[model samples]
Target chain A: MHYTRDNMAGLLRSHDINPTHQRIEIAHALFSRQEHLSADQVMAIVNTRHSETSKATVYNTLKLFLEKGLVREVIVDPSKVFFDPNTSPHHHLYEVDSGKLSDIDAEHVVISGLPPLPAGMVTEGIDLIVRVRRTS
Target chain B: MHYTRDNMAGLLRSHDINPTHQRIEIAHALFSRQEHLSADQVMAIVNTRHSETSKATVYNTLKLFLEKGLVREVIVDPSKVFFDPNTSPHHHLYEVDSGKLSDIDAEHVVISGLPPLPAGMVTEGIDLIVRVRRTS
Candidate 1:
């Protein structure tokens, strides 16, 4: 994806978001960075450029972005929440030491043969989380 | 997978956990039930029999069971956490209406062939959640 400022603005506009200076800067930081970040991390970066950005705003913006499908919220660690700019279907590789996250591009991870829906219930979605730890 | 009381007590003993009355009752409630339950739900049932069963103890027992790999935690919904008794490698189907979870026994959903790991970063695991809405 192109990381140009205009491209980011246009992307936000396409989602009907106002593309404010704070939102644009936040989007750029998220898209430019290759690592997964929490709201605090994003706020830390955005605050350097825009001192007026509040923690509540950052939290709200992230929630809005999540609702718009612009980003994905990951809860690999129960204590912390991570956000990913890549919204495509993929998996994540969590780092135990640094508490970081990376993408897993697998071709054979499609789930099938689901059991019939429970009585008076309809199926919504399937979630798979594979936890791995270092062998050494 | 014998669903009898003695069989479950034996199973717990096999896992090296002391099969106390509370533990056995919790195990039976989880194994016999067909739906995913949260700690609150487990406590609700456990309290019906033993009025002294506190929520804290139920929570602690659940944690112990999870550490022993006897149960799994499902987080399809961000607001509440759910517990699954199935320990095998599998996925989950979440119900949107009731926020219920069911096991998906697909064998072909293993994720593989991801990008190379970054320096000082080790892959831990992957979490895949597919959200489904009603058609009507």
Candidate 2:
């Protein structure tokens, strides 16, 4: 989504998130890129432009974004978690060697035969990641 | 696999992992339990029996185990990573509220329609985790 500062603020407002300067800057850092980024990566990018955003703010804002349904967390690696700006339902392709991520459009992939959920459990989400490595 | 101490040592030797006292203890801690455990959880369990095993040893041994294909890392939660002693290809069901993980037999789940890999990339593995919450 093309987001100017005003539109970014509006997006946050619509989600009932307070559009603070730090939140808007973080939103810009995420939406402006096509890649999924870790919270540390988000902090680095946000600080590159807005020098005042703290690491704590980045972490807090991301938790808020996740709770507000503005972003999704991708956990392909044990060491770091990636934050995805695209809220649309989809899967992922993770490049193992370089730790890069790409989207697998939800429309293209088909998954079936998930066993019946244990009694009294409802699905919150499904994460399907296909890990890949660059051919030498 | 039923692992007496000698069998655990043999298992390590078969995998080319040195059957050090610490590695053996770590192996027993994981293989003896049916549930997936994080490194901290592994350390906690190991230390309960053998107080000398340090955190670094747990981390290093897990990395070694992952490289040797003796364990698989489950990445369902962003907050912590779980290690599965059952190395066979399978998927998982994560109980979000309780953080419990259960295996989904690989043969039972079927997936298709993965997009063609980007040029010069080969598939490594695929991870499918269905996240669920209790219906109260």
Best model per TM-score: 2
Task: Give the lDDT of residue B57 in candidate 1.
Answer: 79
Model 2 misplacement above 4 A = none
DockQ of the two-chain complex in candidate 2: 0.81
What's model 2's lDDT at B45?
Answer: 88
User: CA lDDT, every prediction?
Assistant: 0.73, 0.89
**What TM-score against the true fold does each predicted structure earn?**
0.78, 0.94
Grade the docking of candidate 2. high
True contacts kept of each: 0.46, 0.94
**Candidate topping lDDT:** 2
Predicted candidate 1 versus true structure: per-residue lDDT over A11-54, tens digit per residue: 89988888987788788879888568888899998888548688
